[model samples]
Target: MLTLACSWLGMQWVHEAGHVLGALATGGEVERVVLHPLSISRTDLRTNPRPLVVTWAGPAFGVLAPLILWGMARGFSLDSAYLFRFFAGFCCLANGAYIGLGSFDAVGDCGELLRNGAAMGELWLFGALSSASGLILWNGQGRHFGLGNNGQPVPFRHCAGLAAITVGLISAGNLFFGTG
Candidate 1:
């Protein structure tokens, strides 16, 4: 549950950041971005000439940021690198489902993309690829979660501490920086 909470907030921030970046890249204006913890994240544009690009950026960057972070962690030979991979996979799965399943109702970013000339087939393809990637990343991660045998006992206390820290930091960030 702690990881889920952190992942939720992280996804919202990264996805919104992607929208902001896309808007700025296209010479558009971003009017407001809502990042409330209790609400779904969104970036409202004042002027958008490339809505499709902006819309695509949300999920694209959401998945990419975590993967990049995981890659860097692995490059450093970090012990907790699997956590980063899990986070990346979580982001991908969340974003993919948000785009794929939500397409049925033409909701959220999916709706925006479609309205801006995105083909349904393209959206489904992205969904399939992203979801598959996320699952692949998650494969063989059962040991970390204490489901598999690694010849040693899992550190429950350490995991709990990490979860606590994640919740605290994420909640604090949302309470502070997300208020606007």
Candidate 2:
């Protein structure tokens, strides 16, 4: 449980950091980033008016970060490469699961897309893409559905735990904050 909570915390950082990076990259100035159990928040101070692109950036970064790490790990020596590989798979699973689950409600990254006038098809497609990519990466790690030779599928529990905690907390946040 502690591991799951810590990992949940770390993934939230990565998720929000993605938003900060996206805002910065898109020529927006990010004032601050805050991570709560319910959601990762970013204050973009840029008045430049690039809302759609900036909004998409956070989830894009979440999906891409692990893939980037995995790709870069290919260049490392054999022994050291495993660490990056583990993290890559972990990030992919965590982020993908988080997005897939969170999208079921009228809030979160997917909600941001819809509120910005994105079609339902677009939302579903993005969810499928991210989740599929994560599954593919997980397959490579031999841990899909806990069928790996090592018999340790508990890692997926972390993914599910993230999703559960996110949904519960975000729902609570919405109740308290009134779904701005």
Candidate 3:
């Protein structure tokens, strides 16, 4: 349970860090990243077309972070494999849940994509990408860590509960922090 929560928080940080990296890559100034209740970035930039890229970058990096971590962890000792696996799996699940659960109503990368006229298929594509990546990472990592086959599948109710927790945390953060 501790590992699960830590993995979730790590993925959130990586997701938000993706935004910061995108801002820097696109010539925007990043003020800070808040990681208390949720991960949000404060940036200084002008309104322009780059916001779309910046938004997309979050999930992009979110998906990429675990992959990179997993790849890098390959050269290390096996004892630390669980750490990489947990983080990678969390990243995939976090991004996947954010999209697959329709939690990105009007504020996330998907919302930005929709506002910019992205087709529903494109949004579904994003969800598919994250879901597949997450499943692959989770299953693969489980195998690598000898967690055995025939693991118990997470039921829809559990997924819904997890989604609710995520949404609640973000909502609380936004309410208290003003979504800056």
lDDT (0 to 1) per candidate: 0.84, 0.60, 0.65
Model 1: residues >4 Å from true position, as ranges?
A: 151-180
Per-residue accuracy of model 3 over 27-110 as CA lDDT, tens digit each: 776655555544433333453346777777778898887788777887675445555766777788678777655534654566
Going through the candidates in the order shown, the clash numbers are 0, 0, 0
Best by TM-score: 1
| Backbone clashes (count) for model 2 | 0
Give, for candidate 1, the lowest lDDT window spanning 10 residues: 149-158
lDDT of 1 by residue, 2-42 (tens): 66677787778888889999999999899988776678888
Off by over 4 Å in 3: 38-49, 140-180
Query: How accurate locally is residue 36 in candidate 3, as Cα lDDT from 0 to 100?
Result: 54
Candidate closest to the true structure, highest lDDT: 1
TM-score of each: 0.87, 0.63, 0.68
Candidate 1's TM-score:
0.87
**Residue-wise C-alpha lDDT for candidate 2, range 1-180, written one tens digit per residue:** 433454465555566667777677778886655556655554445452566677776777766775676677676654334334555555666666655666678566767767777776666676677777656655655442344576445455556655675666556545643332
Of the two candidates 1 and 3, the one with more favorable lDDT, higher being better, is 1
